[model samples]
Target: MEKNAAELLKKYLSGQCTPEEKAMVEDWYLQLPFQKKAPAAEQIEASHDEVLDRLKQRPKTRGIGYLKHIAVAASILLCVGLGFVLFNRKIEPMAGLAKKKLEDVLPGGNKATLTLADGSVVDLDKALNGEITKQNGIVIRKTENGQLEYIIQDDPDAVSGTNTIATPRGGQYQVSLPDGTKVWLNAASSLTYSYPFAKNERAVALQGEAYFEVAKDKQRPFKVRANQQIVEVLGTHFNVNAYSDEPMQKTTLLEGAVKVVAGGNEVRLKPDEQAKFNAASTELVVDKNIDPDQYIAWKNEVFAFNNEDLKSVMRQISRWYDIDVAYKGKITTEKYFGEIPRSANLAEVFKILELNHVHVQVSGKTMTITGN
Candidate 1:
């Protein structure tokens, strides 16, 4: 039997519904098949419109990449308004979106996930930093040094070794391979490497943010599998961020030659070159004049913004900190130019904004801004 929406909403409002009841309401509202162009929707949509404006003004967008990316968007959107409500006008009710925030992270941060070869999954968000999980001949441990590492399975055929490491939104980790190939996994990112990566060929799978300084292997060629693309190189330094939300899977070459292949399309890049991949359209583009710091700053414990918009900026913040963003009024489409050190206090981030004439406010963990 189908439950009435009004009844379910009232039950939720009164806190008289079970967990199941609340979920049913959320599913019904958010998953509605028909997109009704309601008149009231427009009248009250300013709040959300303001959010969209703020998002557009900042710089770029993850572009409905998936649910994981959208989770923190609302938090960053509504961050400024959160300190105090907009004057007088009825705030547009993002019922469906609001409910999602409750079901996910409220604001300030997100969680991560770990998958084993055996198909077991660990939610890294709730778990502590050290000694997370182990399985499938893989010893998953957080070293006393406070980084996530995988001990490759020992096998008779294993002349060399490899393993995979991945991180999800509201999550980040670092790893040091036996051969001293250091990797830093960013929010909503993943990587896979072989044990004693073979002499002839070295390969790994990656999505999202990672900084790699490949060990010099004369005999073996290192490769990274991301989305449908593969990046091949022998010895070099580089960063890859291929979040599904963004339009492209970017491979930024720091100091070596790398061949990026998308589908049958292939392109080679030299130092200071970046390969961009579009997952939806499956287009490959070779871009010159790249910014290496802005691409790989996360590895250095910093979030660098270079002429980026609110939507795009919020996307990064949403993933690392796992929050929701909303807004009221006109969402200005503008670009922000700044380099925020990851270790910088929240006040520092706002201070930079204030200096730029970008109005910003912080309430607790949520950070918001008003565009000019």
Candidate 2:
């Protein structure tokens, strides 16, 4: 590859490239010669050495695996890289993250508490798979696959009741709204909606993070109230991150269209676009260049961080692991670029951090971080 192309890839990895530049670099990456079949063990080592040697020719950076070009290339080469490693070595790609038996923290699953308008709470995790309850002529059932779904009866006399489903730390859940919209909540998140959606509009209150695959209803626009922003869409797939600890609330659209309103401003977002709302200002900035997969990866049971900072990564870890994080030194400024399965234990997560010069010490459920 030409030096210019490498430089462009570096920019793309760091999330500094424009939409046009990102597309160009992605095209160039696809054109690279990748192995079609799994190579022998000897060929595996040779390819690894070749990749390492090429990486060594690049400028060194502060953090390990934090090399700008290398990390960028690694993400693009993930399919080819992991396929080779798995087919040849028959080992986990991230062999470094050994299971931490002593302090193993499993990933979050379909766990949440559903609160009815009458103030009755149902533990979705323990509740048997079937009709859990009935409110306002809406039948709430726990599906065999561990999903909470609502079936609205055709009774015109059906009442409307607001219900809330909350996922605790180290827990997550999925629910189908009465309007047939599917929502997947992440750990430490909640979604509140009326059992029978209003005839005029469909609205839901949200906290933390959630992914939505809204059912098409052009007559009544679907609106989500998350933090200080409101996302309105007719029918679309989107992900919203409104965690209180996060610096900014992000609304990323994956399909169709949506209008995000924050403060006194409103911006329309297209597919693959994201709207960021800062707490300090009312200005809603719409970023045309974005990767929706990184935002919704949590719903898919993976932790995907693209040019994410150490503190940001830890926030997700702390919530998912249900652990506390304390900083021993000024290391939150470090940036990481990679993906890891959320199923990994706490110790395994720490191992990945260590590779990036982040030293983590876990005691019980508390984790302390220090600079390397």
Q: In lDDT terms, which candidate is top?
A: 2
How far in Å is the alpha carbon of 185 misplaced in model 2?
0.4
Model 2 stretches with alpha carbons more than 4 Å out: 1-102
Q: Rate the local accuracy (lDDT) of all candidates.
A: 0.58, 0.73
Candidate 2 achieves a global lDDT of: 0.73
Instruction: Residues 120-209, candidate 2: write the lDDT tens digits.
Output: 999999999999987778899999999999997778887779999999999988999998999999999999998678889999999999
Per-residue error (Å), model 2, residue 24:
34
Question: What is the C-alpha lDDT profile of model 1 across 1-372, one tens digit per residue?
Answer: 323434545676678977766654433333211224211223233344454555556433221222113222122222222211122222222235323333343222323455555556666555576666544444567666556665666655444334556665666777766455778788878777665556578778887778888878877788888778888887889888878788668999989788889967999998878888887787899888556666887776666665566778778876766554445445555555434555543333333333122444444445455544
Candidate 1 local accuracy as lDDT? 0.58
TM-scores for all predictions: 0.59, 0.76
